[model samples]
Target: MSNNPMNMMFAWMKIASSYNQMMLSSSEVIVRRTMMMASGTMTLPDAMSMMMEKGTIYATATERAAVAMASGADPAKITAAALKPYSTKTQSNVRKLRG
Candidate 1:
């Protein structure tokens, strides 16, 4: 019962754009990190130790970056408060989908 089909289409387009931005941003971060790890710039043990020591910070930063991308916020500022999370064991509602 909507009067404006064009408006609805535009809204959907905006949502698609937001999702595309989020995917691209997340993929970029993942690919960059993978490249660093694969390039042997850091030893496996060193990387593991660093991740173990800073796992929570890394997770928080990644989540914030994804949210910022989806919301169309400036990527530069996403890490400004990423280390604010106090703990790493926070519960998530995301569930795996089964085909």
Candidate 2:
């Protein structure tokens, strides 16, 4: 209801800040869950690789969600975008695996 452009800007900034906080908390939860899910069968290097890949996926989702929300996009769309990066097909490994 605020007609002042500055007020609207501040309001959006608040929303962005809140989104960032939530994203960070969610990312922590994600990392914790990933660690918990790693069984004793995995090697140290393999576990670290899995953790790093999952963390990157989590981070990318949050970053995209923040950008979408800051751009005045629909919140539902933002949430969906955050969930989008979870698919394994979206991930890429920079390190080449030589058998």
Candidate 3:
């Protein structure tokens, strides 16, 4: 076997760093995605308050949000409405992070 010691070390380090970056990026994505999804879901207070205040609306938070989305409205409007209920600043933030 031919030996190229310096090249092998450089190649290995490059690969390792790239792999580490990938892992970090993926974990961040998962956390952020889950959080965004959570926003679309209803919280306990939202559920209880909606139930007590609006008897006609579904008691489940997520189900209510789903119904709103299914009503053939604009997606941006839907996302905008959902963003305020959650801590995320904007829906575009998620897309920026993804890229």
Candidate 4:
């Protein structure tokens, strides 16, 4: 039942649809949980802490992916390669942002 390119596309589409639904459900959960905190004995600091926890989880996951991608390079080599054009481009971006 898996002998065609069209079938592969359909399979991937099904996976993507499920993934999107999961993301929507997760956002709905955050909205619901935060709503109760907004009216309860929770302080602003507590809400911020929850938000920060979610942000850090995503940040660390992204960092881990980047590390995995860079795993083939030695640390010093990777640092030098990244810095070669990145530093100048970052400065250019900062100037563009300021303007």
Candidate 5:
């Protein structure tokens, strides 16, 4: 990313937007999963798989953040890098669940 002030500000705005979208999608996933469980549509294996998927996602993000920090990236860049996978996954999940 550009180190120019304006560019950094825009990057931050994008990051903020991504975070907001991720959160909204995450909440929708939670609610949908909960409803499925309540309706007996969600099996134990499915719940386990979801949990594992979330753990893997978190682990990937943490690894990326660690690598970014080790490379001495600026905080904004590091955060953006770390949040990338989460934002991508959540948005994908939202689309898939909706369909």
Candidate 6:
């Protein structure tokens, strides 16, 4: 990421947008999964798989953030790194669920 203030601001804006998108996708996933469960299409193992996937995703993001902080990354870079996995996963989930 550029060190320019304007560029940093844009980066933050992008991150914020990504965060909102992730949240929206997450909500959609939850609702869809609930509906699936209600209709007996989603089983306990499927729900457990979703939970495990979430845990893995969170752990990966946390590890990335920790590594970035240990390396003395700038605040914006650290946040961007942390958000990357979440953004990628949620975007993927959105597409998969839509299909």
Q: Where's the lowest-lDDT run of ten residues in candidate 6?
A: 89-98
TM-score of each: 0.37, 0.43, 0.40, 0.39, 0.85, 0.85
- Model 1 over residues 15-58: C-alpha lDDT tens digits? 56555555555455455556667885656774675467456657
**Candidate 2 stretches greater than 4 Å from native:** 1-44, 88-99
Error of 2 at 74 (Å): 0.7
Worst 10 residues of 4 by lDDT: 81-90
Clashes of each: 0, 0, 0, 0, 0, 0
- Tens-place lDDT per residue, model 6, 62-89, is 9999999999987887898899898888
User: Which segments of candidate 3 are over 4 A away from where they belong?
Assistant: 41-95
In the predicted model 1, the residue pairs found to clash are none
| Clash pairs for candidate 2 | none
Q: Give the range where candidate 3 is weakest over 10 consecutive residues by summed lDDT.
A: 83-92
Question: Which portions of model 1 show Cα errors greater than 4 Å?
Answer: 1-3, 40-99
Q: Which of 1 and 3 is ahead in TM-score?
A: 3
Q: What shift in Å separates residue 91 of candidate 2 from its native position after superposition?
A: 8.7
Residue-wise lDDT of candidate 2 within 9-74, one digit each (tens)? 665676566566556655654555455467444467856875687678878988989998998866
- Model 3 TM-score is 0.40
TM-score winner, 4 or 5: 5
- Candidate closer to the true structure by TM-score (higher is better), 3 or 4: 3
| Local distance difference test scores for all models | 0.49, 0.59, 0.48, 0.51, 0.86, 0.86
Cα misplacement distance, residue 30 of candidate 5 (Å)? 1.0
RMSD of each: 13.2, 10.3, 17.9, 15.8, 1.7, 1.7
For residue 16, model 6's alpha carbon misses the true position, in angstroms, by 0.6
Model 4 residue runs over 4 Å out of place are 1-18, 41-46, 71-99
